[model samples]
Target chain A: MLGDQIRTRRELLKDADRRYSLRQVAGRVGIEPAYLSKIERNEVPPPGEETIKKISRDLELDPDVMLAMAGKISSDLQEIIRKRPLLFSKMLRALKEAPDHAILEVVREVTDGDW
Target chain B: MIQLKGTNLVLRFPQVHPKAKASIEFMRTLRVPNDGNTYPLPAGLGSFELEHIEDHKAQLPEDWLKRGGVMLPMFQSEAMWISFNGTYPIALKVATGKINAITGELWTNELTDEPQNYVVLSEQPWLDGYAVEQGTVRQFVATPLGSGESAEEQITGEAAFGGIQIQAFPMKREVYKELFESPKLTDEVQQYLEIPAFLRRCSEPAMGLVPGGSIAQEIHKDEYGLDAWDLSAGSRCFIHTVNSEAWSELTDLPMPHKPISARDYKSANIPWFKYYAQDKKALPGSAILQKLKSKKEKPATKREDAEIGQNMSDLPVVKLRRSDVVTEGVF
Candidate 1:
């Protein structure tokens, strides 16, 4: 899914401007052109978080969305979860199927330290 | 081609190199008094809101739909400047209604070095107006089409198009790698490459940029040479300027507030700007652009003096010099 998403967006950008070639994007992302091609074709697994961020930056896509699509979490986020494993695990499970606004409300309450 | 990323237009070159990307913003600034006196660069208040033409195809004229780009609202006589951000080296050609802002020649698909039809980034940070003279430019003031104030009306004798046109070409990939990737790259150039990621109304008459008051600004010479740009891989965008009232009617968006008057800004002790790069050379004034009469030379049709009060005397100015190191005094 991540590969499809990236490939589709890249193609759209390329359609508008012919310069967004796979090789060029790979070069900018510091990845091998062959490896990027394989990833786009879904023959290889998505790259690590750093590479994903680089690709997202080059493509002007949201890094968070790309990370979510990749089924990976950023190291900084992992650290945050690690610090409060018990509470975060419980919160994440409770909020798994929650609507975005409801989850936002909880985040707002916690951020405001109103609870 | 230009893609609307929020209000900024992102010009991408996928065929050239992924790093060969640049974003442009039209900044709202004070409309300096065009009372036959040149002034310093004004502060950028904010960006103009932009909307894609495809989204509002039903309401737009057929010609606008055919042009197929983005549109922004602008008030008559309002001043604005272009802000450029590039991840890598890019050559940008800017024109007001098919009239080249640099050479004052008619728009052509090709980039030429004889008169230097384009400005190179990230060396050149911003463009304020027509390149009338060396190290000086007349500010871009919006005027309605057919008013005979716009450069288009003056040169072409017809207001066929009443908006800005932009084309961007990135440096050849090999050339960029050889120049920038090498250890010979200067700190100043490197610093300029690392620029961080960073409107209008509807009226029926349509608006085009006219040379307003003169300002001390330079369109820097292309150090990379004309051959360095990958002219084959270039994209252009047509920016439609709609009047504020019509913009509101078409988009249902609130009109932007009037810009800060020059008098108020001056009274507040806000400093105007003067920028100088010690290493780079400024291009000479265009022979054709210099020959055309500025908006000040003609009779004023719009009441601009009332909006931008005429008290422009003794405004404080701040000078910005590049690549200067301040030595710390011994404590």
Candidate 2:
């Protein structure tokens, strides 16, 4: 599914007339054509955090979305969550219970204006 | 110790020689002048068109000719601050016609690029300058070389030629375009990201002030500090660049690898007259200058933090230095 998302986004970038090329994207990711082709075909189970981050940057996709598709979490956020499990659990529960718009607001606040 | 294979951008002047010249001065920025105005290009200081014999192109020394570059005609006392047409770095080979007895070179307002190392004359202080946000518009006043007090400091033995060859590469574009309020980074990266935004706003191709997509960056030298080249204070000159024989006794840097390209002489990319248009980059930008992308060039009082080891996170102003401090002569 993550592979599908990447392919879909790649196509979208092309359709929109943006400068997106498989080679250019792969070059930015520092990978070979065969490997990227395999990734898009879902033959590989997705890569590690670093590769995923590179993919996210080249594809202009969300890092968290890419990580989730690969069944992983950001080491930075994970470290914080692991350090204070109870607080994080409570915050997660509150986030899950919030409305969609409220959750977006929470993300913006959490990212300190970055999101 | 160096070899430059190519240039990033070229500045080609109008095919027809414009005989007009202008003499604008940088009347005091700090300590405020008696005429209480902070901004604007002061009274009596306006762009003028003068009549003079014009060389179609610069006659670079024999060394630079092989590398090839564009040229523009310049007149004495005429000064103007160049702006970056866009957000990229560049190196330039700026020169005027050679003189019979004296040779002239480009001057700068940014202090850290070892200004004294290139100073062929003294008392030709950067006629005047002012800080514009995180960037500056240094007064690049034209003077006939050797007209001012000349120093026998011997920075280079390659025939004290005139005109300037400087580069203006800062950090990579990704780093420069980041918002100023972004997170703090390493000292080196911070310094690399210290270009002022206004410096990139001289003219727009759409506006028709400059030609095409090209934006001009400062291509001169420090506004002050001609004292660092004092041989009496034990200033080291790399013989590899000077002359194998004269610099032979002073071996500070490694020997040059091969023939010196035009870009090699312009190694001072530090906010000097180097810039980017649509497709150009300052190959090896002053270690390179600001044009990166902040809004203001700081004042002298605030630039203390812009020094080595100190995190220049927040600075109000930046001023040109008169002597070597943080870099210890980084020429």
Candidate 3:
């Protein structure tokens, strides 16, 4: 589920003294307690960029991870694609078509080479 | 509820750190036009309000807290300059949870109008430098961050996204109070700078290319057997927050509904009068600051480097790829 991993990761980060309550965390994060509960239960789609930012902060989860989990493409990556569409497109195509073993080999070969 | 019902409605505007020594001299020190009769401070360093907001609590709105409390309007256009050298861009705690750095305007989206602890979430990459049509001969701007493209059309979301995210903090009131009450300016600006260490700490749980440039990892990814360049400016150069005090006051407001539009920015207006729905009875007619005028230091007769360009003392100077680029138009 979209939120299963966030739930697991958030729990891992929480300490006993700082145990986060759904409502407390939700209030700080600007979400409904029920909404955060739904998020933890994997009962809803991941939130938007702004909400994901709040949730990640409230849960002590990495915001980028939460954003990624929520499937939000950050502005930085979007700009990279916009600037070098040809290179990014080719790189994506190569990665998509390459087998794991071949990709590993290419990775090995590139690593073995010096800058 | 106006919890401050009987309390004084004291509103403060940002002023330069009275004690911090300026690295620059002979430049425009005060943002507001001064008579140039005294100490030459750095120009456009931070914001200042001649009039502090002071009124009875009864004047405030009933839903003041709900509407995000009294707001201190920010002038994002007033850029401040700092001189420092770091391979990675440093983040300035312009406000709580909010940071102005070499890269971008970092913030959280809590949407509170209360005196929220500036929960600086992340300096998401907003802008980057493309190999400009002019190629490697890119010159720097008076301000380093914000808007790299000179042309207006290229300034869209697609062209502007920098791709990094940061977690925020709902810091205790004391934390924000410490920041607000602290000296507003410092020469060692890096002390107030916070690195988005979260970006460095988390690995991808799934597939994604590392958005390249001087992001947390991309700076060092090269020496660690990945792709990177010597883009980190060698030394003695930095990305400084220009109009920093506005950013400092921004922490007290609710999150903006949209990205700050420079076209719509009202720089000359006072914060209490503009953003907040309530009105002040009259202007303080805040007299021209006599304190900044007290010094007898005469304007340099043979003024040193009176030119408008930067006065880079003994510090080493170099340029590298910005950690995150904000297009302030071609320099």
Task: Give the whole-model CA lDDT for all candidates, comma-separated.
Answer: 0.77, 0.32, 0.28
Model 1 regions more than 4 Å off: A1-115, B184-188, B193-203, B296-314, B324-331
Q: List the candidate 3 regions with Cα displacement exceeding 4 Å.
A: A13-15, A95-115, B1-331
Q: Write the per-residue lDDT of candidate 1 for residues B71-180, one digit (tens) a residue.
A: 88898747888888775889999999889999999998899989899998888778889999998898888888877878998999988898888888899999988887
Per-residue CA lDDT of model 1 for A5-105, tens digit only, reads 88998999999887688988888999998998888888988899999999999999999889998889889889999999999999999999999967754
Candidates 1 and 2 compared by DockQ, better number:
1
TM-score of 2: 0.25
CAPRI-style class, candidate 2: incorrect
lDDT-wise, the better of 2 and 3 is 2
Cα lDDT of model 3 by residue, B1-331, tens digit: 0111111111111121222111110011112111232111121222222111222123332322222222222232221111211112212121111221112223333222222211121221111111111111011111212333211112222212111122112222333345334566333333323322111111111111111111011101011111111112111111112123333342343322222221222222111000110211111110111111111112541132232112223222222222322222111
Relative to the unseen true structure, what is the C-alpha lDDT of residue B327 in candidate 2, on a scale of 0 to 100?
30
Encode model 2's per-residue lDDT on B1-331: one tens digit a residue: 0111121121111121121111111121111111111222211122221111011113223332332322222332123332222212222112212210011223332323332222111111221221212222322333333333111111222224333232222222232234222456334334322333223111100000000011212223433223232222111100001222221123232322332211222232212222222221111222112221211222532342123113112212223222212231122
Q: Which ten residues in a row have the lowest lDDT in candidate 2 chain B?
A: B203-212
Per-residue error (Å), model 3, residue B26: 44
Q: What is the TM-score of chain B alone in each candidate?
A: 0.88, 0.26, 0.20
Interface RMSD of each: 21.1, 24.2, 27.5
Instruction: Give the DockQ (C-alpha) for candidate 2.
Output: 0.01
